[model samples]
Target: MDALSRAGPRARRAAAAPGPGPSPLPWGRFAAWIDCVCVVTFDLELGQAMELVYPHDFRLTEKEKTSICYLSFPDSYSGGLGDTQFSFRLRQSGGPRTSPFQDDGRYNREAPLTLQREAAHYFGYVYFRQVKDSSMRRGYFQKSLVLVSRLPYVNLFQSLLQLIAPEYFDKLEPCLEAVCNEIDQWPPPVPGQTLNLPVMGVVIQVRIPSRVDKPGSSPVKQFNQENLLPAPLVLPSVHELDLFRCFQPVLIHIQMLWELMLLGEPMVVMAPSPTVSSEMVLALTSVLAPLRYCCDFRPYFTIHDSEFKEYTTRTQAPPNIVVGVTNPFFIKTLQHWPHILRVGELRMSGDLPKQVKVKKLAKLKTLDTKPGIYTSYKTFLHKDKSLIKRLLKGIQRKRPSEVQSALLRRHLLELTQSFIIPLEHYIASLMPLQRAITPWKNPPQIRPFCQEDFMKTLEHAGPQLTCVLKGDWLGLYRRFFKSPNFDGWFRQRHREMTHKLEALHLEAICEADIVAWMKDKSEVEIVDLVLKLREKLVRARCQHVPVREETLQRVGLYIDTIIGSLPEDLQAVLHHP
Candidate 1:
């Protein structure tokens, strides 16, 4: 009979039950099983095998080396095998037993037929097995494999599908295939070329449990924001202590100094969240310490804070540049100087008036009227009886202050018309005669009647004859008629005024002179002249009551005219002030 018929009902049921023969073990998992068999063969030869394997109910003796010649049944065998029923045999060899056998109650099985064919092609006579307990409940084996191969240090990696959860792998195959196919279509790497691998580029997401003050308190809320974490953290309910024990040797082998020395390049370790625990940071640092001289060993962390909140508000204003000049020269010449130099205004620095002999006048002081002229005029008008009666009638229904102001304005207008106007007209008549008189050779003498007439008009205006008139019309009359050196003073003042007018006329004509002089003068002289022209223009602009735009444009044209005749280089310098 075949092995199935001899094994009773269970073997018959296993052969008839399945839709497929456990599908095929994934390539990686089958290779891992072969590797386990190879290790067992080596260990049993040295009496270091961790599992007791008795062939025909005989314990392996010291110095009697046995090996895993084959781990799977022949193709002719037709029964579903149990976990402990491996097809290994003992072999007698001449070797001193160094290590004692350790029975760890573990066994191995052959891999599926698909993996056996691949193994045979790559490594001659290789065998694979799945280690499991004696009962083999529900056909669930440990996440470990064994392999027997003649090749040295050759390991086979098991696919995660067979080792962990086959159902999950079956479900995820479509998605995984799509991802893998996309990756396969990418451009191939050049031959003999090493890629510049990124140092650390993994993001691990950890979800912190909410803090509560007491039992049954509401759980802390999680932010409903995106990009909170790259990957979800999975916390399993049941703890399997030996779950990772199978990989412990592999981890130790990778981290060993001898293994690292064999590699031409140093290894780098990247962990998530260096801030989480100090021990993890220290451990990573110590592992890379040996390769510090040959490689840049850096450990990076990717942490996302759950409590962090970000907000964007308004921006701050820019800084201001404040330029101040001490003792400015243009303060003396410029009219309406305060207004011209008003803060935040756009006046140029050169247009500022000079701080010379001309005193800085307040806005009120610079007005045409003398100090307290309006007040004195109002007081004088109030004392006049005729003016008072007329003002009372005119402002019968007005407020007291308004009535007073109206009366004062009326009296001032009457004075200006009757007294000031006649005086100005009489002075205007004398200007022609005065101009005709030569001061030195034909100094004209004033008649006694003309002098008496002027005095009579001044005396007739009673209280109106105050300091404003005294400093203005009255002052001029006194200076011309009363002073002993009247002619000398008048002539001197007149000469100064004429000289100023003449200077202005000369300055205007100099533009033409500059054009003429440019032909004969050197570049230095021409440059000096241009500079002087600019200074005069600036000064003229400053002297005006409120510097006129037309005056500035005229001066600017004069400058342009002079500069246009100069050489290109010199013209550029003189083009602007």
Candidate 2:
């Protein structure tokens, strides 16, 4: 499912698109919080600040909702509706919202609770009942007329006040002056407007609607939200809200109402098929772009309910999506690409105003095929079981469910975030090891030498140890003596590696070994050779000093136990027959 859409209701119960990520937001949070809470309880720190996360016994009760009064300004008595309403009363039942959207609950009254009391500090957060279940979302939410005790918040106050109660504007001047003058801020307040709060910054805006910024009296404005005037909020596929719709005024403001999850970066599509919905593709593209990620399916693409979320939560790949065969095979932008699975799907049962609904959406059948679905799918499975095994290897290595789809784009999934940083860190780690161990491949660019470097290093080391530097480096002298059979195996493998590396060498022979032969090495060559030597020696040394039958017997005795000591993932390889 798309990350934005994952915030909706139905996506909760639906299994994630086959092997993509976890369930939608609430579920994902619930799972994580479960583990967190378990630890808190175990540690007897339930009173810790973090323990307030969805704890039990503290949610709303239904009776409290029936007697409360909701706030809404009419043309008769108001120019703008401010945050404080001096009104109260009403009651109803208690329940949690199925989705993460604001204002989802069974309540009869709009809680007139003060931001000062329930949540005092300007930015201090509190999850109090606005009614029974109404509140804001994960992203930045800004109201123009939210009353503030501080002067700096005055212009903001007027802007949103107008949105809530336009008729009350004449009264807004004194409020704006009192506050703005105190802060010595702004060119005063404007009427009939909503503020654009892209990432928490706010600005005063006029009621007129325009897509581009037209310069307001205020100097600061949120990115993508500048010049946006107050208007009926528009979203895409309300269930899969087009979160960007609010900023895309006049372009068919939509509430997507569709669950379209994106990874961290924009997915650069490589497939040939393109029958998928352009809007869906655009939506997913938008999500993945800013987040920096990629995808497997196309737009309006249905993914297995179970597999859907795997794409968003940075989870492991589903068996089929990774292998290139989707269910219905809806041809997409880049082959039968994996789509932002519908992590959520919802249909309203109670009466709802038409102002909130749009009729352009539809449910999609998964384009990825399932087991026993077709010949190609089975063929794909058979051919890539090893690939699947490899793909799953990491997941198994750590927590099987640790794989995360992303809240951003696939490329920028938080799991993959430090990609460059980790690579840099890894390179840095290897620098010292390479300098100390490798006297041949210097300034090691291990990437290019991945395959052939070690083989050559081993081959060179063998000849030097056994044939050339047969002194202190000599096996027998240095306690390197081994069983004949083990020696033969080691020698043979070394020779093969040496031959392959020699064949792969693009330049002059890197034969100048620091131990036996020197002065013929490049920084690159030295680094490469050292890394190769380290791999063989360290792994071998860590486990066995001599490659003899006795060693195997002793080591093999602890094989299962040793592998078990390793991660569940790596154990798979050790356990494999």
Alpha-carbon lDDT, every model? 0.29, 0.25
TM-score of each: 0.20, 0.18
Please give me the total number of clashing residue pairs in predicted model 2.
Answer: 139
What is candidate 1's lDDT per residue for 306-325, written digit by digit as tens? 11011011132111111111
Residue 215 accuracy (lDDT) in model 1: 16
lDDT of 2 at 540: 43
Q: Model 2 segments beyond 4 Å from truth?
A: 1-279, 282-346, 349-415, 418-424, 427-577
RMSD of 2: 29.4
Highest TM-score scorer: 1
User: For residues 95-208, what per-residue lDDT tens digits would candidate 2 score against the true structure?
Assistant: 332322112211101211110011111111111111111233322121112231211122233233334333223343343333222222221112222322211133333231
